[model samples]
Target: MADMQIDSSPVRTVNVTRYVTPLREGGSLPAIAEADDGFLYVLKFRGAGQGVKALIADLLGGELARALGLKVPEIVFANLDTAFGRTEPDEEIQDLLKASVGQNLALHYLSGSITYDPAVTVIEPKLASQIVWLDCLLTNVDRTARNTNMLVWNKELWLIDHGASLYFHHSWDNWAEQSLRPFVQVKDHVLLPQAAELDEVDAAYRAMLTEEKVRSIVELIPDEWLTASASDAIAADRREVYARFLTARIASSEIFVKEAQHARKSLI
Candidate 1:
């Protein structure tokens, strides 16, 4: 991002102690695992189909959501031991673990959380607007009602599963033209009906997400995850591009905010 020094207090390293169970909802196949710190974490493997870029998005996205005062599980650096793979009896999981025996990402497990249900849950309009605003700013396309990727732990909503964001990076050729693209998926956002202060939420978050704050989140991405070829000028500064995109989106949030607001009206 910028040349400013980023604080590293958010990055914590933990050793993977045991593989618990597989969460097969998405293609990534992330699993629940116990770590050396005596806490269970939902480990996101680097070798999964989405590869390193997904991990990068997960880290940065979670941090950005937290910055906007949203509740997010703690993310940590998971150090996988090569031998851990040999203990697995399942061939597919064994291969996956063997391939991911190094620094990976993990989200602290919420011991007893329920998936969000709009039919029963009563979300504050402000919180819903903030959530819709954050998802739009990040261009996250995975927050629809069918796949909310949100959890209700201790009777509070918590954000999770941010890897689906920054999908623009998948095909870099015409990325620039699509950088300022509108988020059409807001129409299906699960919390749209509960959102009543899109403009206020947008303004507050825009003011809060300064260059340094965005850069700090970008900096949390491990260097190895920024693996795109440095030969391309844009690829060389992959971190910078991510931060710039977020800052740009924040500056240009009016269109998306209006879209969200319009979607809210359409519900009436």
Candidate 2:
């Protein structure tokens, strides 16, 4: 998180004006839709197989990346009307749209961007370290060689599809304990071999992501999204849980940092 900058600007809200096409590449079946703002966005449906928890992960992970001065697509809250996708021929997509009629999540589409091919594109150690560190902090398990959830937009790396991050929330049984554990998945991170600056970035990132800042990022999650996932847990209580977990995790960054370093040693 060197040269750290926090984008505290609240996420914008948009209305989905049209459902252009579905992006079948992602298992969630996210689509490219045009919003009232006259921009194309990759819409992540609430009714997707992963459900609202995935939306929550997207918001948290994307915003946290932004907060840490990483390159991430603009995220927005999209409202889908009840009659949005009725005319569609596909029953599965139609039902998906119907079920996602309320609020959803979307990333401002980066047109003309190409998927990051590690073999062709080279990443400097610092940038690679930053990405690896961010994923470790969030315990993200998706950024692998097979499906590197990264893009080369404007010849720079842009992270996307964070719906698979923060997986501990899927079964909130031991979230607190899970937070302090090392992210063993860092070994498989697409950028691990290039992430030679893990130790250099760890302290700066931890200092930048203070408890207040972490809570602010967690608070960006919509109340309905939290309540939808946890019928028994109050939204406020859940927010605090996330805040505490992230804060504790950051405080223990040394643990994961060491693990990532060890993994990198094995690679080199």
Candidate 3:
């Protein structure tokens, strides 16, 4: 595992107002608030017993994708300190505290009943290709053909939800080999025409997202979500897979088009 170079510095502080709203999904809680500087934010509270692992997954996944030169939403860790003096003190909350920014307003109020469909949100085949490529690199099995956890805002796709990855980390050594294997075939597919313009991804982004970064991110996950040794093993395995996928995508000239082709076929 390589050393991760993420700047664990605080970016900004935000005030969150806790007025919970309902989503169509029915389980998650959304809050509306404004940052100190007046920017709107949407804060989605993790469900009971889910802990802060979901938040960690979102933050780490978003950060890694951003480093890989993908167009993800501007996401940062947020702390939910209640007006009544209640504080989230679990490991998950503690990890979020390290990168806490401001609170967020629930997106449902801003976007209004936007269906979580890949075809509708990722309308372009080229963009879809990049998303699929990114997901494969991250080992995010949750973003399947049917349930695309994304938001289409200002004509762009914003990915969300990544707590399900690194599932194999619960137990195993040399997990990198398994993680890096799926990407051996990425070169065979076409990514996007625009990918040609993105010839070089920023080195700082790559350096910040080494295996160490993945481990640190994993450490923030609640122990309840993952037991001791098995969780560590799963995290290692997934990180290795992610690193290999990133290397292949960045270094290769080939594009991944299988998902895009399938998407197109479905449209016809």
TM-score of every candidate: 0.92, 0.96, 0.52
Q: Report the lDDT tens digits of candidate 2 across residue range 167-243.
A: 88888889989988999999999999999898889978988998888988898888888888657878888888888
lDDT of 3 by residue, 1-268 (tens): 2222234323333455342323334233334444443444565554322334445455556666655555554554444454411344445433433333333212222343254453344355445455555654555666644555666555655665555544434333555455444433223222322232221332233354565654454444333323322454455444544455345433332232343334334444
lDDT of 1 by residue, 110-206 (tens): 8889999888888999999999999888788898888989999888999998999888888766665566777888888999998998888888988
> Candidate 1's C-alpha lDDT?
0.84
Q: Count the backbone clashes (under 3 Å) in each candidate.
A: 0, 0, 22
After the best TM-score superposition of candidate 1, give how far the Cα of residue 33 lies from its true spot, in angstroms.
0.6
Regions more than 4 Å wrong, model 2: 1-8
* Decoy 2 TM-score against native: 0.96
Candidate 1: where is the Cα deviation over 4 Å? Answer: 1-8, 228-236
Better of 2 and 3 by lDDT: 2
Specify the highest-TM-score model's number: 2
C-alpha root-mean-square deviation, candidate 2 = 3.4
Q: Which is the better candidate, 1 or 2, if ranked by lDDT?
A: 2
Global fold similarity of model 3 (TM-score)? 0.52
